[model samples]
Target: MRNRLVAGALCGTLAVAGFTGCGIPERSEVRVDGRRQPATESGAVNAWRKEPPPRSMSGTDPEEFVRNFLSAAAGEPDRAYYRVKQFIAQEDDHRLQEKQGSEVELTVVRLVDKPVITPDIDSTRVTIAVQQVGVLRTDGKLAPPVSTDTRYEFGLRSASPAGSVDDGAGFYVIDPPNVLLLSDVALRDYYESQTIYFWNSERTRLVPDLRYLPLTVPNERRLNEVVKWLVGGPSDWLRPGVVGLPDRTELINNATGGNGRWEVNLDMSGDDRTRADQLLTQIAWSLPEFDGQLELKVRNNSVLTEDLGERRSARALYQGLDAPVRYCVYEGSIHPLGIAGESPGAVPLDPGANRNVVSAGFTRADKQVFAALVTASAGRQRLSVGTGPAPVTTFTKGPEHTAIGRPVWLRATDPHQPQGLVVADGRLYRFDQNARMSQIVLNLPPGSVTAVAASLDGRRIALIAGGALYVAALNLDGGTVAVGPPRRVATSLTSLSAVDWGDEERLIVAGAAGRPAIYEISVDGALQTPLKDDTGARVTHLTAFPTNPATKLPSGAFMYEANNVSYRSSPVERIQREQVLDVTPPPTGVRPGSPSAPFFLF
Candidate 1:
């Protein structure tokens, strides 16, 4: 459950780190006045409106000039510098203009305070506060409002026209502050976000490249902008794993959609002729958010594919980041659970088999099970990957830390033989049983890793280091996994002990729940809606049904010890007590009993 809508919930609508999975807005329809319009796209849900020209600052008050300047700053992305120049002194204009490339994008901002104007005989200094909403960076990323208290020093020249002794409307910029201040809010009434489609490296699936473009223009115009950005390619960060298959192909005109039909007019440039269906497929997939069919047109060209119906929707054609099963440690052994509620749901993994297995790892895609096994010969822990009663291949002979997080299986180029990732001694290891074992060095806080989880797409990985959550994009360098600078998942969370991907967008986390005693969190490190209040339960290990996304995670397998009994349940069903063995010993100050380590869907 997520927090309900409230004031100061400006960042609530901010897109989660990835638009490819759980954060993708479910299909929604829009109303154009009384009549219905196509399903509204993200960020573009604001009511359709003509982009009015920037207000004239020629004779306006200082506050009005400031207000108008904010519009100018964002109204044109390519001309942000000149627009800000309109509100700055001529002397300072050249500086802001030349440094435009370094400028950050800020569109929806609020005037935080009443302007404090101190008029002098020759000039005036007006100080004001501003907050911008949903900041759009020049690099094309969206973040919540920051630095709301930023003070912009604006130098005002009140040279009276005709020397009328009245400042009147003759006020212009004398000196202007260099930094822009802004805050973000839920402005579905004024803005919309859109998903630009791109092809995964395999060209088998289309991943989304999301952008928050201004809704100041008509929906079709905004769609044209989306198409252009799509053609340009994925963002700098997402480009490593995805390519724009339909990108580089020009749209002859703005795309138009209505009444379940969309028209995509193309220029047929740069291999467009050879890959027309690919372009149509990308368009079909991206546009179906409106529940519409696609009609592609190339000017003066004969009808190539007459029924350019939408070939796919990004959702259905795309099987998001998981296999369709879940595995749990029930009754001291690995067991399987149906993701879509399948048959033989809670069967013991290797019935009657004696093993030194502590925490087992099984991928949802297939039953290629791996576990942290105690090596009898060396008395050290190693990752073992196998199919049946006995281990076949060893992943690591660890000299690492004593505690290890559950390993995960990711789809490999071979599809049948997926690779694995695990954490030990605060270091990440990526290995294939038959191949190489390499350390995934990341620039993160130093400490033994308590938990690790990978996204279904194999593009990002999340880890808990020193009780804080960090996420990083994955890159393949030659033959090993490389992590980019990890992005801190900071929010209201404190003392995070365990984490798992609940869905594509959120993470199911446990710490010390809410203010009233509940513990749940999203991937962004914000509080999730509590499942149940005051169960007096402390979750030590958590796992989700991989097929049915754990977005709300109200139901899932978790082990919590209450009164010396380790009980594992779906958090909503009858509890089944398991023998207490070795719990990961909840990070120093906390106490609970359960051998329940991180479990997964096999």
Candidate 2:
């Protein structure tokens, strides 16, 4: 773990899995200083910063200096990268000093093996071999690597007059690579993940975009970085799904704030007032974690005359979208999970109907509705949708002895009308607003889509097909639905069983290269972090909730299953996964006697 061993090296290939985002919670509780802790340090979490590595010691050997330089480079980008520059040769320091930061920069997150240090008569070379994990850009967006095997050679010369430290006493890196090399442990210590917001294609709601900023850096610097990234736009993979600030919309001045209030000035004087409201909306949602009054001005002119002091909350802007409770379908009834002070009783969607629902997905918007895959008989299944006291409408039936995954409810483009997606056998189908079911053609990799999950915003979809994972943009044009070209992501995952959206940017996936495991992967196919859990059984189901901007906590309960055994993460535990037995026992809650897919009511 210290080395950030590339996922492929540790688990085989890059079967990306894990969850990340500002309002979203990661799948596992990270351990630090021998105690379990929250995965992120944003918002009200305890403030602890990773100490910066010390400056190079005098008379240190080439190997020691190289090691120290790497450690320092992993921390906050110091003024001119001074601390790291100390280990460079005198001639190399001038080059680094004159270099200006660009829109993006590559940072090495994992090393495939120990660096090879070879010393010669006149120079030393430190060859680092790494498997591409992700490219951390200067704009705070992470891009997937174009290559898998990356090698960097650091050439060193003696700082002494002899030109070389033959006895390994004195040396400095004479030739340094352009990219920063960081061990995985250093990445975790020095960086904290944060999410900024962008407008959805419809500009109806803000979508979450994830970025990691240095924990040791000052809050103002971090805030400025977040704002700049928001202005620069979303990451490459997310660009197609979200809208950003208008073109050439650059921050005129750095974001400055302390205690709570912050002010952002932009160079959008040429833009009209119509864009001003949308601009403020994006800034407010993106900075929800900053928790303060925001003053926005374009070329020193106020965007709005009304005070926005109370409108800084993302929840205030996007209301009624968060799920109030999680639900689980067992036998023939739906029951709420982990709702306090309420009886653990079944809520009937169809009164007097014994449909024998085995798995279900529901949506709660203007009205409560649910879609269920009912067991018609042994080896046969039927998909149905209904509301309270309404006769359940059976829309489609699956072929005998074939597999049908849990239906995923898509965020409706039309109000009060819900839509859903299901994958039966190898085919994918969408349930339209009128309860009409139709198959959506896909040109995915040569594998059957066994599991599918869609983002809450209805902008993207993730699929597990043929033991691999794929992602595509979900395009809703009027009443017609279209899936953009599918891109094969997380090839590092040799096999995949279940997939679900952890947030707008990350996916919670279950599968393995050598053993059954769960991983959180960014939607872009880069940045895979394993979810620490004890379950050895192959994960069969995953139920995750994006962080509710209102609570700054996960929207609802998080649960997953392995070999039909269910586990759930309580609100008290945040996103840490635990066996459901600790919360409730059989015949009452999630202890479904047979295979079931648990989900939150969203």
- Candidate with top TM-score is 2
- lDDT of the candidates, in the order given: 0.48, 0.60
Q: Write the per-residue lDDT of candidate 2 for residues 1-602, one digit (tens) a residue.
A: 11111232244232122222333443333332212222232344335655555644635555566556666665544342665676677788765533456733545555656779897777877898765666666665666665555777878777666644355345677777665555544544566656677776777766667676666665556557777888888766566667777778878778776556667788873555767777666666555444555667787776753223455643354456743445565445555554332223234354444356667776655544555454556767666655432234333444343556788877736655566788876788887544466888887656677888987767778888777777776666564567777666643455688888766566777787467876766665545656633347787788777544443444423577777656655322222223111233356455434324566664
Model 1 TM-score, all chains together: 0.62
Q: On residues 1-602, what C-alpha lDDT tens digit does candidate 1 reach at each position? A: 11111112222221111111233322221221112245555345436542313435446466665555545554335665665665665555654524445365553444446667787777788776554333566534454445444456666776456457674545556666554432232222223444456665656555544454444554555445656666666655466666664434676756766555556677655554646666666665554444545566666363344333334423344343332333445334454432223332333334434255556655433334434332222444555554332333334444434555566755433345456777765677775644244777667657766667765556556677777777665654443566666655543345555566644444555555343122333333322334333335554445543222223223233333333233333333323322222223356776533333434443
lDDT of 2 at 357: 66
